[model samples]
Target: MQIEVLNSQASDINTIFQFYDMAVEHQKKVFNKHWQGFSKALIETEIAEHRQYKILVDDKVACIFAVTFNDKLIWGDRDKDSVYIHRIVTHPNYRGYSFVKEIIKWGKLFAPMNGIKFIRMDTWADNDKLLEYYTSCGFSFAGTVTMEQTEGLPKHYEGISLNLFEIEVNEVAASM
Candidate 1:
C-alpha cells in the first residue's frame, strides 16, 4: 500500500463523494450521527490546496483523508507543532483492512517530512469508538473541548464538544 497526495487534475471527484456518502451512512449506523457531507467546491479547494490524500492498494483508492498544518478553528489558541488530520474515509471495498492504522502510520512519517513535531486529530466527544481507535494508534487522549466559536467550520462542529488526540511525532515514529 502507498499513500499519495490527491491530484486534482487526474482524480475523480465523484468517487470522493461516493466514499463520503458511504461513510456518512456507515457512521449513522455506528455512531447514530453522521458527518455533514462536504460540498464539491470544498473538496475542489482542498485538492487545489494539496491537502487531500489517498491511499492506494493495487492501483485502487482504498481510503482518503485530508490534513492541515493548523486547525485554529478546532484547536483554537493551542501553540502545538502539529499537523491536523480530518475526514478519514475508507472505501467500502477496503473495509476490515484497518485503514486508520495505515493512516496513522503514514501520518507518522508525513508529519516529520513536513517539519512538524506533533500529529493531532479531533472528533465528537461522544464518539468513544473513534477515541479508542485513535488511542490504539498511539494518540494520547488530550481531553474534550466545546469550542465557543466554530463559525466557519463544518456543520458538525457547530455546538459540539470535540475529543482531542495528540501523538508526539517521536512517539508514533518510534513505534512504527
Candidate 2:
C-alpha cells in the first residue's frame, strides 16, 4: 500500500471518471452528490489546487479523499489546528476490504503532521451507512449543516443537507 499526496497535474483523470460513474450508479448508497464536484474536470481543478488527496494500493486506486485547511469548522483552523475532510470514496469494487479504516488511521496521523489537530468530515443526513461507518471509525457526530447551494457544483444539488462528524487526531491516537 502506498499513500501519498498526488499533485492534481499528476493525478489520473481517468480514475476519477470511472469512480464518478460508479458513484452515480449508487448515489443513494453513499449519500453524496456523486456528479457534483467529482466530475473529471472539477476533480482535476481540485487536484491542481492541492485541495484533494488520494490513497492507492497495489497500484490500484483505493480511495479518493480531500481536505481544506483554510475552512475552519467547530474545532480547528489552518493557523489553529484542524483539517476538514471533504470527499472520500472507495472504489465500489474494492468494497468490504476494510480499507476505509486504514484511510482514517492514516488521516489521524497525517493531519497532525500537516499542522491539523482535528479531522472533520460530513456526509448527507440520509446516509446512515456512511454515518455508521464514520462512527465506527471513531468519529463523533457533531452537528448538521444546511448550507445554501446557489453557486457552482453545490448549486446543482438543491436543498441537500449534510451531517457533520469530527475526531481529534491526538485523542484517536491515544485510544489506539
Instruction: Give the winner by lDDT.
Output: 1
Give the residue spans of candidate 2 off by over 4 A.
1-11, 28-34, 37-41, 72-80, 149-153, 171-176
RMSD of 2: 3.8
Candidate 2 residue-wise lDDT, 1-176, digit = tens = 55544433444677766666676667746444554544556676677877766667676787676676654332322224666776566787677766657656767767756766777776777778778888997888977766564344344345766777877777558346
**Please, what are the lDDT tens digits per residue for candidate 1 over residues 28-94?**
8888677886878888888888877787777688888887788887787784688888898888887
Provide the RMSD of all predictions against the true structure, rounded to 1 decimal: 2.4, 3.8
Report the alpha-carbon TM-score of model 2 versus the true structure: 0.76
Instruction: Name every residue pair that clashes in candidate 2.
Output: 8-47, 81-117
